[model samples]
Target: MKKLIFLLLAFLAACTSTETKKATSGSAVIINETVVASAMERIKTSQPGVDQTLLEKGIRHAASLWREEDGNPSDFIEFVKANYISDPVRRKEIFTKISNYMESVNGHFNDITLDLKKNLDEAAGEIDQIDQMYGNYSVGSHLSDDFFSNKIAFAIALNFPYYPLAEKEKLGPGWSREEWAMARLGDLFVSRVPANLNQALNTALGNCDMYIAEYNICMGKLRNEEGKQLFPDDMVLLSHWNLRDELKANYANKENGIEKQEMIATVMERIINQDIPEVVINDPDYEWYPFSNKVMQNGKAIEAAREPDTRYDLIVKTFRAMKDIDPYNPEMNTAMMRKFSWEMEISQEE
Candidate 1:
């Protein structure tokens, strides 16, 4: 997910800034222009030959489109239907246009809250019906918005297919623009401010704790507690494990400014390095297991194709490492290999 990548980017930047402007003196807003600049530089440096001029053009077009269709509710629906029948090239162009509304240069964090508040209302109205029919509604900042199908911003999030799509082109898992922004703030904005986190392990743990709390608050605000939650249980659990593991891995490399990385690692060790692995999303062996009996028994273990993700090789290695740490744990060692083989079998049959 881009949200996770953003966090990793922040971790990589590791430029802890303390530029805060005080309103009354008790607290201050740390809109570190230096941090933003540095972060942007890091991103550009990593992307190799990404066309800056082209990206800007794309973002501007998308914002213009949203602005033009601003008042109408049905516009997005028509927009989605158009995409459903679209070929890859068309889809790319459409999303390139949509990307403008969310480009980092335009102002990644400015008025972000207001932007989401406005868009959430639009998303809520559009996604409710889609959710009822497709099993993936209520996935955006708004209660009814199905972000996965609504905009290119959310669509690109499927850069790594988190799950194996069942039927026709289905939605993937991730936070919406608003959700992504909020999490970015927690990861980049809040963590950079002068705090105890950069000093000692406890302080670092404190920062992680603060991040987790802030994350919950953001979630609570964006996804109302009493509202109907639509994300699949297994998917949600996977996100939890993933976020936990990411934090752990990020914290593990404590050179330079990564002193706080251990706190996350400490917490995750509690989660994963347990006596008995716990079930995630009804699948007890989901996180720990290397094989799925269903897949193995079906003989898909020998033939299922590996799923696509952020980086196919990297994902496989991560799973392999998980398996390696406890080679005796068959769940860890053989789950993905078997499951992937099975998936291939089903695909061929269809």
Candidate 2:
């Protein structure tokens, strides 16, 4: 039975992975060998003391991102020649300028996003479905597109080439603050997700968050199989975090702690399995017996539809959206790797 369940879970995972691959795969501009060689030669002659290997890697990385939309090969060559700064002093000055500007940009974008979604984010008011939908809409989804279009992203890529996490962990201790900042700057352009994909991801995550936030279980409406009231009439618990925490708190209830814990676990299982009735969710209009998986309205038995696989479907959508952006990133190719190893700084096995 456990093997069967594992296989079922694996099958679902595979389905989402396939969907993500389909969404992300595409043809992109290839910077050929000739272009790389020419650029390398140009940089070496023009900028003598600059590290040759770093120059090669930086130019290649920048070239990989360049599209026909940006310009033809000759135009790309000219831009590289014009923009490549050899003098260490001048390069540091440019980094300082970029760092200052980026701080301002980051601050303003954060303020804008917070302002746009303040109502939905706050715990104060009764947010309807419409508000949830609007909150899902991202105001800063197109920032990457704008940056790439304006050649600012290309400039950053050309100057501060990214180093992998492993490299950083090994070398970071010896690095100065400014050097560390430059490494972080390099990290920004390592991946490119199109504006549409960004919007889709933001929407999926927003929906999931809103659903979880509003999934309040009216503790008053819950009953055991024998029709015994388990919780106080006015007490409510949000699923699944608050509910889980409440269950944890029940550990000190030495008399009925195990029974209460079992009951909450059953409710959580019902929710995760998507077998919980729709009417019981966030609705105090119905009484529910989770163990029996039954519902009642107005002291009479009533039928209700099972909640749709909304949580699972949202996971799939998020995966697909992330997968769409996979091609643009070479180093951190998959979303899972990027999230685990890079963002969370947690190893996969752990």
Best by lDDT: 2
Candidate 1 lDDT over 1-350, as tens digits, reads 67976786466334323321121131222323343234334434554554554333222222222322222324433332233312435545645554464464335443453343342223344433333222211122231122322454323321211222231123213546643333222111110111221122223322333222222111111111223222223332223445455445554454522432333343243333221222221232222222121112121223323322323233333333322222221222233443442233233221
List lDDT for all candidates, in order: 0.30, 0.81
Clashing residue pair totals per candidate (backbone < 3 A): 19, 1
Q: State in Å the error of residue 131, model 1.
A: 38
- Name model 2 segments beyond 4 Å from true: 1-27
lDDT of 2 by residue, 281-311 (tens): 8889999999988999989988889999887
Query: Could you tell me every candidate's TM-score relative to the true structure?
Result: 0.17, 0.89
Task: Report clash pairs, candidate 2.
Answer: 24-324
Cα lDDT of candidate 1 equals: 0.30
Give candidate 1 misplaced runs (Cα > 4 Å).
1-80, 104-107, 110-350
